[model samples]
Target: MTARTRIAAVAVALSLGVGVSACSTTTADDGPLVVVTTNILGDVVERVVGDQARVVTLMPPGADPHSFEISPKEAALILDADVVVSNGLGLEEGLERHVDAARADGVPVVAAGELVEPLEYTAGDAAGTLDPHFWTDPQRMVDVVDGLEREFAVAIDGIDADELAQTSAAYRSELLELDAEMTSAFAAVPAERRALVTNHHVFGYLADRFDFRVIGAVIPSGTTLAAPSASDLDDLTTAIEEAGVATIFADSSQPDRLVQVLADEADIDVDVVALFTESLSAPGEGAETYLEMMRSNQRLISTGLSP
Candidate 1:
């Protein structure tokens, strides 16, 4: 072959090789990649998986899981992960399509939210809708940890089962401790003052866990994406006045305008407090991790409901 032809062929081969390498680098690496949809589940799965795999959380800190959508890059990560973990039952409203696409593409997905003994709205316009915000109750999150460990170990090629089990157990212990502390903290609130009003119906599990009454939600639905109707607001305002609720809690990740409307409509003395309900906050904000989120919420709820 001519020398010029040989040089051209070598350059072509080098270009093709670089393309292949870039594809491999973008797709994945040595460790298993577990893509989690929400920061709350991301933190819990991070605890269970430990260093066994690389956990990539799609939702950012302080972002709403119910409405947060992943970018194309993050969607690619989901498709490439060894296993995709999502909080199912409609919590991830914006990301569901991408998650479904990943599942169709053959990625094993563990919807940890399904592992919980699910709660449904008892009495609201959205009654009977499954409550997807199960992390409000730490015991339910313990169930999530159990499911994640099982699925991650099965899907990840070389994940250490022993390490996963130990980490899950340790995390469950911590959740139990949190449950106990929350129960005790809530017990301080008088029964009459245990009424809960919130920006949305995001805390059914918490109310069920701690024996508090879910008087009404400002949005009248399980999701913040749903706005309350005029009648809905009117009825809730009446209920708030009748229940003599002292506090209305709003999500820290959401704008408080709708909640402010409710407080104004009620025209009563109600403290509007913010809680890290649907998402964890940035580090040092007291709701960085799942455990930290629960503790901070517990204190807030206790103080809000105190007579």
Candidate 2:
């Protein structure tokens, strides 16, 4: 080959080598290690992080956030994480200690619910406390997305600020759209029929957002671990009758025998609707993601509330 041709061939090879190296570098620096406490929050984190983080969810699909128990190995994984995201306001009752340990280890932990304004509930006799089930409100979840983006930026060092900002904007827009959809869906129901009775105090955020009153819960506490006394059930039955609540929503993960008993004792025509409240559904099932879960619950609410 001529000397000029040889020089050109070497230049081409060098250019291709540089391109391959750049691609490899980009791939290697793509994201950081992220640990999410539950599958529900994990879905939101995945959307915000996109392809920019290695997100690991501790809670398995279909696991109940209220009662989920993690192994020692899982705790270790959380301790080693760059960032740990939790639903916060007390959703993961069983995993709180693990999260506390992770924080003590100096791992950055973000509570998505803390970003949004929380709702406080006071049973008839107990002291008031903050409710942790915030994902029920789509707009509040937008605040969670914002918190997730900020946490992601801190967790994933060297992230392009422009890319992060753009992602946050896009996700916020989607959340606003979801909020509008939910508003329209619930608006079709008469205002008097907007009350909800659930297996537990899981819909406080939802009720607050959509102007629906949470008339009663079969279980009076936010977590299912708290059992309602017979008097609690009696009070709830009274409230259900007074509010004319037509449906009692139960968690699909919890046994419905108690809810059924409450329904029978209430002596009212209250239908029980099982919903994916604290956990995402298994793959191929509806409510597998945060958005899907909200949509599914909205449908159930609309159907139940319709005359």
Question: Best candidate, lDDT-wise?
Answer: 1
Segments in model 2 whose C-alpha atoms lie over 4 Å from true places = 1-31, 124-127
- Please give the range of 10 consecutive residues that has the lowest summed lDDT in model 1: 15-24
* lDDT assessment of candidate 1: 0.78
The top-ranked prediction according to TM-score is 1
TM-score of predicted model 2? Answer: 0.87
**Whole-model Cα lDDT of every candidate shown, in order:** 0.78, 0.76
Q: Tell me the tens digit of each residue's lDDT in model 1 across 42-87.
A: 8888788887777777777777666666567777888888888888
Candidate 2 local lDDT, 137-250, one digit each (tens): 998888888877876777777777678778778878988988999999999999999998887788888888899987877767777666665566667778888888888888
TM-score of every model? 0.89, 0.87
Alpha-carbon RMSD to native, per candidate: 15.7, 19.3
